[model samples]
Target: MTDERETVEYDSPTGGWGSLRGMVQTALRERPSAGAFETLRRQNKAGGFMCTSCAWGKPKHPHAFEFCENGAKATLWELTRYRCTPEFFAKHSVTELRGWSDHDLEHEGRLTHPMRYDAATDHYLPCEWEEAFAAIGTELKAIDPKSAIFYASGRASLETSYLYALFARLYGHNNLPDSSNMCHETTSVALTELIGSSVGTCVLGDFEHCDAIFFFGQNTGTNSPRFLHPLQKAVERGCKVVTFNPIREKGLIEFISPQNPAQMITGKGTEISCQYLQVRAGGDIAAIMGLCKFVFAEDERRGGTLIDRAFIADHCVGYEEFRAKADATTWDRIEQESGLSRADIEEAGRVYVAAERVIGVYGMGLTQHVHGFENIAMLINLLLMGGHIGREGAGICPVRGHSNVQGQRTVGISEKPELVPLDKLAEQFGFEPPRDTGTTTVDVCEGILDNTVQAFIGLGGNFLRAVPDQGRIEPAWERMRLTVQIATKLNRNHLFNGKTAYLLPCLGRSEEDMQAGGPQTVTIEDSFSHIHGSLGHRTPASEHLKSELAIVAGMAMATLPPNPKVHWKKWTGDYSLVRDLIAETYHEQFHDMNARMFEPGGFYRGNSARERVWKTKTGKAQFTAPEMLAATNVADADGRYRLVTVRSNDQFNTTIYGYSDRLRGIEGTRDVVLMNPQDIKRAGLSAGQRVTLVGDAGDDHVRRIGGLEIIPFDLPDGTIVGYYPELNPLIALHHHDQASKTPASKAVPVRIEA
Candidate 1:
């Protein structure tokens, strides 16, 4: 097939007229109601709905137009005029809709009614809310509680998440898994073990006081575009910015703030990173260790002045062992594993050493690996060596992709008992909550394959599309006895209906939710642990739609036996009661949630690390030192490229807004792969040649994808990049972080085929 492509070097800086054009184009494409413009004006404001995109923190005093271009796209996508009513489903059968692309399916617009699948007609027919709830309750009651899986997406509010978790536990099961299991589970595990906190220590204001910022594996351009303003401010103040990744992401290089009228008029952008180091995929452990090695050597040269000797002596433990491991690691080994030379690593290290206050930032690129846990641990070790954390503008920031992923985890959407506090939960909810561990995202897939998990309930996510090993999960998903999805729009996952399947529509975050107490507000936590309330001003898309809180409560009311202790109906009627209960459950952080949310920027849940009060067993910050220098295996000595999954500029999670990846200079296509120019020649392939990618998991799965055109670019010799969810099929379900169970999507072994 001939290549139909337009791949060129992206020259312009990120967030200039390009962003302005995107915002206007998306608004026109969605053709939202007149109220949509007013909705955009209030985004991220004190009394407005939170941007349903990345989990970046909102500023204490937000500007007039506080939302980013991508955030506007998300709002417009939800506010589209098109509706997927029962009439639309009648026209297209499930068998036929399965052939539709993901973007096409969702672009059809918001779901208007609760519908159930009809196997005879292969169509979804509208059903009453009462009937749908009764059917789900009957199926759930027939199965063992352990055999049902309750999954949630980060789009849910904290109140809804708290209710979802309580319902699962009350049903005598603890299998509650959400989006966090796939994204920042490694950060939660590593931080909890070492520093006694699972969230970042730096607030949005920290950017003002920092001397340097080091970025690893995070692409702020598409993932968290709102953060570019802070980076731009840091650069303007002469704060050193360094980036380490396999690809030179455009956002890290330069940015033009749309808020800056002068810069926007001039079309001039501020340069972001002072140094860009292209590290190999899954090589963060080695790269971080090299920084530690350099710091240790510099301290030796300065007569022990470079390292924070006093802070280390007072606040940290296990330093001697970590230093010894760094001393023993050879420069040649570090260079080989990191895909960076000694001089480059040292040059980056010099910036870290010179800055008294620094921030280390990263995203899924570092966490979605086989040794993801160790990668986070090694980063902590590097910060501990310099005593960089717990100070002004100095800490570790794990940039979350979803809007409230961190908030969901903060409010008991976890499979682990330790994270959720099962014992206290049992006391409050009046049930014997299960003490045993529950299934994670990976475990849910395994259970479905084995037929041990017979039922599935999803809250606002396309589970089947976002997971790995789609070939294996898709077939197993059909064998389930029952599946219920509470969502706003129709996606590919909704098409794979089980024997008894129901698609229940919920209110979007941009819509006003009216309860008995009047229009209610829901709260979400940002990446920095700032808890704030989100209030929507627009009208509902359909009169039949219900809020997520009501749907979760309705499911619980129908499924569980009558119990006076739990006020399911009343709690849903007045959401403030839900917040009160949550406050009772977690008194320390959420004592007065309702009142505090009215304050500007809400409240900050102070980090223990920032207070210098460690919650570890030893009562101090701990340094993790593993015997081996590299956490995970690198690329094969033979010729094989490490596969890295990425997202397009116009996408959020699995939802595709458009086909254009503006920063990469690709348009109107997703079926393409970016490869190193040298690697393409070695594989006997030319640029723009249609080729296939075969997975090398050392198994008999025959995991391969075809019809992908190759685009040559300047990157590491043995690395290739492809869009996520599309390339998820190549990653084995079992290939995940052993400690956190996050899929190692960053460094899958693969080969190119013609």
Candidate 2:
């Protein structure tokens, strides 16, 4: 009865007495005070709703639990009490809910009706929401809408990602695959080819006026723990920070700012990096070409100027092919592929040549890997070799993880190549749209392994445990003849069922949408682009749920077509006419974006690289080169090891909020892996033993996803680490990130066996 792989390993923290007994069993299982102060007075005020966890940037005041601990477990998992009925999916079948665990199918609750997957009683029955939108609009209008894909989920809502990218370009198909193409598509294709905007040109008061921050491959107090109170107030106002990261993240080496009430009443904890380094997980493009080859040899041996040579000769453009590829990258191949030490990249390039102002922050650990867009164009060529692009505390930030996924690729959820958002959605919905370039979560599971993607909808993620060869995303989600989803709670991609699936449910950004013209607010852009306005306060846990803008206007009114071309049921019954079609297709940046999203804390997005004004195409800011490749998970001629995949301060993104990973003192257990006592005596294994990692299991392969333990520590030699979507079946969705396909889930290549 109870053993959905020990149901989210209870309070799972596998180390120091399971993180002090899972923080005294989450403070004696809390409760009583469920009124979460009217959901924290509807977050960022002026209505409310946007904190579905991390993409931080919003507190210009408003504390008292201004959320974090993964935004209060995404606010008690969108204020859960747990639901899921239709007799709990006609009593659990899809082969016993495909052996559970993804925190036991999101702690088995919150989903109420509109289901489908019958496959002759393998269960999940209740259909009828217009018969599961006329059987998903007659099997996606008999396929070939480039075989239908769709996807999305950064917990949608910029009016349901502009009505699911205008109902997947009015069902003709630009596939729309999302979850930011398996996380930060190399920071939106390397900040749109170096500063034409793919987002993050500083904000959050540019981490309180930089003067060196750096941080690549982010671990910001376990992925944005309220960005450790603005990086412990930029290290108590002496600002330096540093960090690189291959693993040394004890919250970037010491951080204890429980929102600094005098360092959480004197248990004191503010010593966040004044230098940490580590490097080597795909050595951030040889540590940004060894910090731009030590800022071009400290501008040729301290000659007074660290190469901003008049902002690279007036705002840049291949400074002579970026100074002949930063003087053809040497420092002994950047200290032999950045394991760091050319006097720690000349002492972090002498603190980025005595910082006048720097920023750099990064994440998706430098964009998932395999030279993630030349490790984000070598951290924008070490912040444009020190002139640090576009002013006010310098630029390039990228720390986004859904809190509006870079405003769903800035209000058009692109797959764009010259489908220029299907020619601005056929000049705002009249027709001729779907120009093609579709499929992308790894080209929709390699277009469902060559049968060419036969209809999958998704809209809210966990798509087969956030894709990347989950045995080829569970048989390309059982060669789907329609797979739907839309969800709120209940996951493992709704038991990966699909010879026709559905699911539906919805409404959670903390409830209360009401609609038919009453209380409805939504916006959300954040990670420093701002935007705001969210509004849900309780109610609607179920009166048969709904609102992801009424199930994307009831699946674009039973899969569009009849009288379509945009009215989509009066723009889903008013979301200020989906912010007046996002203020008439980004009218010089959402004009009055629904009257400045009702004021309070909402609106920012102007950023011409925050004033250095270089929206590229040779207008300025361009220093691009990135062609290094050739480092496939090193150490192998019989030495094995590489691995990487991390994340566990009670996880998020592949949502497992417990079973203890309180800053790497593992608990309950996520199998464990760490390693490095001299690569466990150079792979002769042992320190708790039990191994078996092997690799390349591409499409739904598993062979031996057995138990592991290992531990050791200081990690680097020929590395290893573990933890992502539980070692994403040892990664192999064609080993990703070739110019931003993303999924190199941190380096990979394995062979631990034992």
Candidate 3:
């Protein structure tokens, strides 16, 4: 906790020699097995593995080095030579392993065999695959299906998710929780209500032709580095890239494409954002409403020439109410809540009005709050006013984090029965799927704490580490009757084995999956809804490791009684068979998926809103007119500062590659807090001083993390920034979006203790 704060100023733009050096350092540190780099070379290419870092779409003609620095790190981490075999587990008991850091737990390396927890020895002993499967099936059969939760992470492929969904449904439960529930679930709920589609309508090619793009609450460089390529090109082509974020992210200010040899050699980079507005944490709603208010004022001054009156009359509803709300919202209130001047908001509005085509893009920053749904709804209102919903280069784009999170949702991983086609699944599989709505990510934590959830099946994720209220979830996790984890590497989540827990090793995305039909190619859907095939070129880390598809099949085959319709063995042998079933279930969107997946750059699943086809209840694009405009995160008490959790450059979601945040001029530590200089001064604290952050958890209980060094930066007053998972404990489980249940990680109220 007393880690020294080594502030290393990184003056250069992101993605130049520094990025290249990071990639090289990652490769050297991981010490990957043979052919790892060779497999990485083919990433995002035709017949290549998909990078698991982010869901950024690949260009139609991908560069030779399509993978970014974090992508390379993910590949190397999976393909590393370090192995956590039974012998490794024998050396360290579960109690001792709990004392290890998350990085050390994963750095120990890939799990090589299936292991079962031994309570007497406090160690994980190697177990046969059959024994693990039987034990899981026996426990599952003993408990009511409603008492179990089937959780899927983004790492699972479309085939594996489809099979897993079917298995969970057949097992007579709708308790399916996924990573999306904690991230982009608000996107699904908001977009579906407004535009009748859950996914983004924009394609990767749209960025090239768009005249302007409005980015809200997303860090492009760290979360999705490959996206910098398109942004750099857009800047080169004179497109106005406007950004609204709490932090003055380095990537959005300027970017140098490593692919551009000339710029790299010259040490110069293209300016990314034409204007960057440092909005306060959870101020996106007010900021977007301010833009809408400005647009309405301009349209009135121009005699309605600026607003798309015809499009609104023909294709949208509730405009009159939305306009009334915008007209009632005053400039003084907007400026105060958004932490920006009226002139700045108007200037950004002028940029929007001048552009012929624009794309409204966002990330979890907008979707992980109490008013998450409203935040996105207001953005949709802005886009609808400009007629940006259905156009060649204009639409909504939610840049997802995980590689296959969207694909998993598309393939029927959801807690809402209404979102997925339950009837079709039941009819196709010859069993009635549970129709009742199921538990979400937050609900799962509550269920576990109450001991109502007896068993949990994790497809591929560190569930305990990723979710909020980690301090509460860990002990309850151990009380469960059974826990099954299908993963590739060792993580902190693997150590918390319940009464009966099994760790099943599975193939990574960069490893070969030789089925009975020969080498297999799995499919994943990007943030843009483009479906592409991924085939690993590298060998499997261990001969005993099974494919995720196989592991799900093994659990299902062992649990369920022999059914005439279901063929688990055949489906596991050939993934295409699973895809065919998916085609039948989601016929309109994924019809002929097998054939279309082989097409050039794959194929888009198609968005209804993109074609001006609204499938909402009103049969048109809908608009939400909130009664009032306010900042989602507000100062309820004196000295309470708004805290936003973020990931470092060297880390992905819950996966830490290194301790440094190179882009932010910090090195050798992730425990430092970035605060505004004025705020630090007001709090009677100085830079490099260690402090504790206590959350406003709305109860008598104290939730705090101590020994975090404070580093003064250029952030807004009453706003501080810290790393995620580390700060997750301060965020209460109930502090989340009411509609989506995504934890409000972006805006938690806390006070500093010197």
lDDT string, candidate 1, 339-393, tens digits: 9999999999999999989899999988898888888888888888788889888
lDDT of candidate 3 over 1-754, digit per residue (tens): 2222332346889999999999888888889999987987888887778888799997779898998989999999999998999999999999999998778888988999999999999999999999999999999999999999999998789999988988888898888889998799999999998999998989999998999999999999899999999888888898999999988888898888888889999999999988999988877888999999988989889898989989999999999988888888888888887898888988999999999898999998899988899889988999999999899889999999999999998888888889888878778878778899888999999999999999999998888988988887888889999999998888888889779999999999889999998888899989988888999878888999999999999999999998898999999888999889989999988999888885556688889899999989999999889754543534456789888999999898888998868998888888878888777777778788889999886766578899998987778777889998788988888889877889989878888888
2 or 3, greater by lDDT:
3
lDDT agreement with native, every candidate: 0.88, 0.73, 0.88
Q: Total clashing residue pairs per candidate?
A: 0, 21, 0
Please state the error at residue 211 of candidate 3 in Å: 0.9
- After TM-score superposition, the amount by which residue 113's alpha carbon in candidate 3 deviates from its true location, in angstroms, is 0.5
Sorted on lDDT, highest at the top, how do the candidates line up? 1, 3, 2
Query: Given candidate 1, what's the lDDT at residue 611?
Result: 81
Q: Runs in model 3 with CA error above 4 Å?
A: 1-9, 631-634
**Residue 528 lDDT in candidate 2:** 79
Candidate 2 residues 617-713, lDDT tens each? 7888777666662234344446555678877877788888667776665567788777767667766766776687777423355534557877776
